[model samples]
Target chain A: MSQELSDLDRRLINRLQDDLPLTQRPFASIAEELSLTEQEVVDKVRQLRDDGLLTRFGPFFDAEALGGAFCLCAMSVPEERFEDVLTKVNAHAEVAHNYQRDHALNMWFVMATETRGDIIRTAREIEHDTGLEVLMFPKKREYFVGFRVNA
Target chain B: MTLDPKDRAIIEATQAGLPLVLQPYTVVAETLGIAESELLERLENLKKNGVIRRIGAAPNHYRLGMTANGMTVWDVDDSLVDDLGDKIGALPFVTHCYRRPRALPMWPYNLFAMVHGASRDEVHAKRDRVAELLGDACRASDILFSTRILKKTGMRLRGQKG
Candidate 1:
């Protein structure tokens, strides 16, 4: 539960989701909005990172346009080898994210590469590496995840 | 959609992050020997064209105290998926919703929607709301929580080499 967030923390989460003002000392503007000192805002943000309140800060770049393509791929693993397979699959530099879902396609991971061929190559390599059939669910269409879950 | 040399360089310069300074874009522009306006214009263009999703802080939900995140998968009738997906995606609690392929017998779900909340029960309740919305269109579904982040990196920037 998001039970540990402070009042200031919740406000920061809500406001920071928007792009920070493109000014020198962007934190200053944010501080003004929250009626806190610039140093306080900066310190709070740093603390949030240390506390894991923020996963990332800065421009969110598009992978496909940046000379690379990404695909959401998954594999069904035998219970005995789940952890072992996860290690093997994640060892590849191309694999950016991996997740265990409650479905037959239980083991899911995202593969990114400079080219589409590279994406396919890595998918095959993951199959060989894990001794499991890697089901490639390349994205045909993607919808923006603009979900703003309030704190 | 690829960027020209200048655009590529600009992206490369700020790809890591905008230096948390007074004039972050200006700092990037100075390094590239381009006017700040030009750099800003290109960024604006990129945003308009959907190349850059946004310029903001991506806070970790778990850290922000809203930790229960579930990847809710739905097996809706093929014909009704897109229509239903739009509705599901629009839910304030649901952040990402999309139509993914069904792997059949084993992977029977095709539509995916991500829901987040303060607790697992909160997420489960949201899932129920989505299920009720789908009604008979959704045959079955399940939720998957991410266990770990094996690797984390930004987009693969070709500008690094070029």
Candidate 2:
């Protein structure tokens, strides 16, 4: 269920998505732009995060630049062991984003590790752990990344 | 180039999220026993090196009224992948796009582009546009609308729990 959002909240979401001033007084600068007090802007930001409206509010790091390996892996688990497989796959610390999709290659997850070999090894380990065939789809190239989302 | 110990420290400190304050650097640096100016300088350098993509508010798509999202996969001819992937990635609504290796029989889609919208119908329309763009070079395709997100941690190093 979606919650009813206020006009201020909508404006905040659109504004905060970009134009985050990098300054000594970032919040104060935002207040100046939005005509609200620094404290009010700060409080609303806190509330948005608390309400799970804003997932993150800080430095955005790209894994590839940090010498880390990131790839998407999937598996087609039997329906009888779906829950059991989900629990096992989700338990790993390296699983970045796991999703239950509507296809035969259903169980899809993003795997992040320190090395390229880890991407291959993790795929094998997951297959062994889940007793299912793992299809590793490591990114060969990135055409575009971190594109601006529509506000 | 290797990561400086100081840079590593700074990233670890702000990995979760930075403080919501006037002088966030001052607060973060004070905790790390460093000067605000010094932290700012390092952050600037990191941004230049592409380590830090951005220092801003990363809004949740669902909260922003983008309730429908799908990962559109395509099996395009290898010769035209570079041409096709770039074209699809350039779409305004495509958030994330990449070319990945395909496993035969089971998985034939090598190109992946993320499609998101306010409704499922909207998502399908976007997918059709992509398909039309791919044309005959695209041999096969499939879209996997995420039914559930079991786990999601932006970026985590080995053995590091978020």
Candidate with top TM-score is 2
Off by over 4 Å in 2: A1-3, A146-151, B157-162
List of clashing residue pairs for candidate 2: none
TM-score of 2: 0.90
lDDT of each: 0.78, 0.82
What's the C-alpha lDDT at position A102 in model 2?
A: 92
lDDT of 1 by residue, A1-151 (tens): 3677799988987888887654445677788889998877767776776676776666777777666778889888898998899889888988887777665667888888877899899988888887789887776555556677466
Write candidate 2's Cα lDDT for A1-151 as tens digits.
Answer: 2457777877787677774555667777668878999889988998888888888788887777767888788889888899999998888877889989999878889888888888888888788898898788877988865455544
Which residue pairs in candidate 1 have backbone atoms (N, alpha carbon, C) closer than 3 angstroms, thus clashing?
A1-B118, A2-B65, A2-B66, A23-B22, A24-B22, A24-B23, A25-B21, A25-B22, A55-B60
Best by DockQ: 2
Query: How many clashing residue pairs appear in each of the predictions shown?
Result: 9, 0
Query: What DockQ values do the models have?
Result: 0.54, 0.62
Ten contiguous residues with the weakest lDDT in model 2 chain B? B153-162
